[model samples]
Target chain A: MITLRQLQCFAAVAECLHFRRAAERINISQPALSAQISQLEESLGVLLLERTRRRVLLTPIGRDLAERANDILKSVSDLEEFAHGARTPLSGTLRLGVLRTLGPYLLPHFLPEMRRRHPDLKLYLREDPDDRLLDELTSGQLDLILMASAPRNDDHLTVVPLFREPLWAVLPLGHRLAAKDSLAQADLAGESLILLEFGDGLREPVLALCHAAGSREHADFRATSLDSLRQMVATGLGATCLPALYVDAEALADEQIVVRPFDAPAPARSIDLVWRRTSARSPEFRLFAELVASHLPTVVTPL
Target chain B: MITLRQLQCFAAVAECLHFRRAAERINISQPALSAQISQLEESLGVLLLERTRRRVLLTPIGRDLAERANDILKSVSDLEEFAHGARTPLSGTLRLGVLRTLGPYLLPHFLPEMRRRHPDLKLYLREDPDDRLLDELTSGQLDLILMASAPRNDDHLTVVPLFREPLWAVLPLGHRLAAKDSLAQADLAGESLILLEFGDGLREPVLALCHAAGSREHADFRATSLDSLRQMVATGLGATCLPALYVDAEALADEQIVVRPFDAPAPARSIDLVWRRTSARSPEFRLFAELVASHLPTVVTPL
Candidate 1:
């Protein structure tokens, strides 16, 4: 027979432990709250509060019951908020699954704006290679994934188009190609190109681009995190590729790596957000996605 | 607006994915349970269960709601059981307070039987010097206290009688008094009696009984645990006093010790059950107490 109104009234009184203060806070009349308390106690057949004019005491049993009431009320509140959020914008916990190659380029620009617009939003950013984030999102662990589209069909989610960002080639600071404004893919055919390890987001794209350019294979070095790849490139150990936004930052502190735009067919990668249509995404999630999409492209435009 | 009952119905339906099974388990008619779910949905202005004639599937948001529902239900169930068991007699947790002296003598025999009779009951036994349980009882932490009574006023709890057991004088198994039929307080004069350290529950009574016999400055040793005192007495050491039940078995265990009743106004420690006036000493706690007291006198029956 307990209603949300009753629970709200009870919770206020139980927490404040003062009838007048609880009533004042809840914007209800003190006499009404008192009458309601009397009615509630009579219905439950237990005394919840031992009140004196100047003191309030909780019976041993009352203390136990209050703890349960608090948990119940909180659960119900989450349910209501979640249900409402599902119909509007994406909200709650939005696990943004990202591709490693795209992550450093996109996140630094969009996250701050997303925070300003969607204050209730929480983003769990996971950067991996290829379509790995999409697979996790499909299995219900990760909520949404942002990655380059693959040739294989994705049955799990509805992929929405974001934007494509161009890729560039990186060489050591004193490399022979450092003085060039831009270079064709075949320009570095004789040199070994260091590759990232498996599941590296750009592994397939670079391989396909090279295969089309009539190269059998290039000298290969594999690295995982971006900093490691940058370290290899800075020491003139190998040539690797990068998204322009990553290298466009002021000047490289190492001053040894020369990053140049790709001149052949202007290689670019598609970035998209894939989420399970069968999964609950709150309104806050939608606002965050929109905010990121709006701010990210402008930030990447200078590149 | 969702009651605990409605949430129960919803959870059952969600988990079992069957209305008939859930309704039967809850002891409600199928139609009635379905109506409650419909009502819950209408109240929340959201669809919680996705139902088709052939199957019932949770909506994406409904899946999230179900997890929250379970948490709320579990807490609510614990609270309801706690509240209803208040006067139901040891149905759940019983916070038992015992004097340090009484615990060794009483717990060994009682705990095993209590466990057999009330498998679900949880006994939190606390042993302290005096009636510290009484303070806990008043503060709503403890349900009962097994302690020796003083002529002090207790406003919150009524006392129930526990068994009264006699005391015995402990000495080396083959000491001179080992063959005596019985000993008087006067016989203890000029003989040093080892006592428990200060703050022991039996100290006051033992000191009073010894002083009545004009046995002054006769202290030999002081101990903490009764076991320590008994071990000291077994080593051809000075005498230490103990309740009849403890040495009733130990006397037979060793030929070096003797068991004889004290004849001159032997000091008696009355063990009583102290419970808060508002205590919900469930049925099991009361039954368990009776089981304990009934077995006390037999621990050291007069031989």
Candidate 2:
């Protein structure tokens, strides 16, 4: 029988494609790691890795087995987490994935609250783009994900709405619409807008808003972060839409950029806490979601 | 002839795994996109996608082909960029990949300078982890990458040293060493340090620093961003190391956190501008690198 340790060693080697590096990654001696790999190969009656003087490459079957091994390891990890969750509510480590746009702004407030309330709970955070966050969450690498737009109609996952964050329009200080107390979509007609690139969850909503307002995305420019968008706006490239939480945390103090609210019925996006439905920690996650809702700043409406 | 359009359609389908969504992503009708996929499959004599009423899946061969198609598309993009670069330096869209830890702090200062110097240049930025940045740079999806500790002895790439950034020690306001004028490696012995999780370029250096100082990493917690690290330190989780640019930009004003420089021969990392050696824009990138070095604040020493 192939032990979990064997699979773990193979997975590490498959990922790094270097025996020495993989050995170091797992904190084992190179010869010991090599022995495990050799034993596993002999048991399976197939060669897994082709070793040259300077390079290591996986066989086709090896690649397929490595993926299966990762899945098995993830399942084992989930089982361990389940056992741990049975004994404690929020005391142990919880791997949380958060969106890049939200992590910087929300975590500063949320983490402190978590530290204050659950001192024993140790959170391991990973900030990534929305799709990658979702991928990691589904793969069991992350216990929970906090994102603006939750996945729709996925039976394997549970999403809890945490808040509704308004979208604010950001413009250069000397722009024509900057003097308005509150701007409507119509006011943006024919204006150029700078937006984040595709794959960002915020981009689609901003594109929809631009389409409704007759504004065009600056054909040649797409910012990678909220800071870049603000900088572009500051440099008079074009206006852009930012979430209320981000505006409050990062943009309100920028003298060159003017942030304005929308007219009645402001545009907003739902913030959610998502986890696997099969997770044993569902109850604790739901409770933690409430804590998150309570700790959010007043700029966003908690659900 | 198998057209680029067919490959684009197939790549989109492979990425989204849903025909309707893929078609929408590429801004084409579903039937039109399907026809393109069919044409490509017929020409190649292989089944690329297995489409059912509820889901779209890729065959094993489809997965391999999709990756190759992407590489071809990237090469085409590079050719177009080469032509554009030859026409006018820094006038067209330049896809730049930057490190997540650096972009937020540095771009606010850098973008405005770029705008002032080259009004026609449209910069498309993607801020990701170091590995992803390097992957994109080598894959031709990005014109350049700004990162620290660039890869060594890679003949396929060009590395331009930009600056050296000092690392600072961050502690909670009332911590034992908070009142000290400056800190040294000896002062950090036996301290519990919170560091960013692995895959971040900064983590390894901080871990080495911890090793040299006899400090140990906080095993139970790992932060995802510099902000999270700051928050963790603010809440007295433990001390952490932060780059000088980040300290100058974000952490200087936090009353609860004390940012102190290291004693003589402070720990530091090298920041470099990296791109593929085959890129036709090498001259332009070198000039842009110089501009970046010049715009960086006094907190970091430009190489």
Candidate 3:
């Protein structure tokens, strides 16, 4: 049988992929970490790492077990968190993973409600793309993930529908298209559309609508953030699409930008609150999701 | 800050959801297990399990951590397996996950080769759906998975394409369609197709082709395995589609069954060997995949 201490040592080495660095990360001496790894290998009757004069590398099995070891370690931490949450019930720290596109625009609306409802709770937020959010959630780095729709890979997680927010066509205030009462797909024909760089969850959907509208992506420029895109469009750089929530929360303040909805049926992103299926705080998370949904501006339709 | 013993205790209880049964599983006394769990909760400052007078239930966090504990335990075992395999390459036990549709036919051809090449190697085979195989692979329950195509949720896994096996139309001897040199999509019009029940990865592809051919699935009776489907077709029950490799491996001796390919641009299933991204056995598994590809009959095209 393998011990947790051995696994912890193995995981630290696997992550850093270097014994000395891994030892440093765990605040253990290099020789101590090295000994633990060697002992682990001897007990398991297999060589997990390849040690040379200058470098260390995991054997194939070492690589395989490294991930499992991380998962295991994360689980141990999660068990502690579960117990803590149950005893205090939202009194401790809650790590939340948010998408960059939604973070700045949405957090302001819900944080107040959360603080008021659970005054003892401490909220820590990290923003990234959908993929990174899901990855962190799986590794127990984040207690819950708030993102656009539930991810396709929800095999081990539960996703609660929060709300649906429609998209808007963003243009320079003085642009001819901006004068239109409502934007039509045909209005974008032969135009070059601006969009955020790759890895933004909004990229695909916007590109699809761009293609459907006979417009092509702006090959030269990709904005790093929604604010950058709005700035570029304000200067007539190119037209782009943004979710309605962003416009309501952030864009309206910029008088140089014009935002409009497409005809009756617009492409909208469904926001969801997702957490591990086995999380001990299902009821709490569910309740939080409901509270967040209720707090969302009426412009954003709650699911 | 939790110890391995505490995790072991929590995991056993989570698995059985009963203190007594969990203790029995771990060869510890019920009171000991209970004490460990309580200590774990106290140390973590959270509650993991909700114990009622009548039953044991995992709190949401308990369920979540249970999965992590299982992964942790599996990782430890994997470390040993990894070490053992490294000391005597391919000599120790290799747990392989195979799809139900492909296993019976595919294994016979390669098992002998595996034995001849690595005499001391012990192969432990498991047959399951593609999703489950991938899930187990992620959780460290399986070292390698042989299945059709790469799974969609393979961000953390490595998939090496092995071969492409075209599908075959199965018919009873003397059936009107058997006389044709080759089958066509229209030939299947109005026919009732027999398919393995849901979760068999092959079902979706077959159903798509069936729908394209103006045919419908046999709703009344669903066969559990390819052999059963072959038997049904052989008895003049109904016609079905199968991968060419299956026919070569299992149906060659069945005189009552007639198998034929499509006219052109036939639909084929790509077989691949999948393993965790962190697995150290890439070179070895890749070599095995190549060996299996080479051993595959001419009917299956090696990648």
Q: What share of the true interface contacts does each candidate keep?
A: 0.27, 0.00, 0.46
- Give the TM-score of chain B in candidate 2: 0.72
TM-score of each: 0.55, 0.38, 0.41
Candidate 2 on B1-303: residue-level lDDT in tens? 355677789889999999999999989999999999988777665556655456666643465567767765564444334333425566656788998888888888788988988887778899988889888776556778989899879987899999888999999989899889899977999999998976557898888898899999998899999999999999989999999989999999999899999987888878889987766557778889988988989988888
Tens-digit lDDT track of model 2 for A193-246: 898876556887878888888998889898999899999999998898999989
At residue A117, candidate 3 shows an lDDT of 83
Error of 3 at B182 (Å): 99
The runs of at least 3 residues in candidate 1 whose Cα sits more than 4 Å from the true structure, single-residue gaps closed, are A3-63, A76-89, A93-303, B1-74, B81-88, B150-155, B197-199, B217-220, B235-237, B249-258, B263-266, B280-288, B300-303
Question: Which portions of model 3 miss their true places by more than 4 Å?
Answer: A1-88, B1-35, B38-45, B48-303
CA lDDT of every candidate? 0.68, 0.81, 0.80
Using TM-score as the measure, which candidate wins?
A: 1
- How displaced is residue B178 in candidate 2, in Å? 0.6
Question: Tens digits of per-residue lDDT for model 3 on B2-58?
Answer: 777887899888878788988999999999998999987778766677665556666
The candidate that achieves the highest DockQ relative to the unseen native structure:
3
| Docking class of predicted structure 1 | incorrect
lDDT of 2: 0.81
User: Best by lDDT, which number?
Assistant: 2
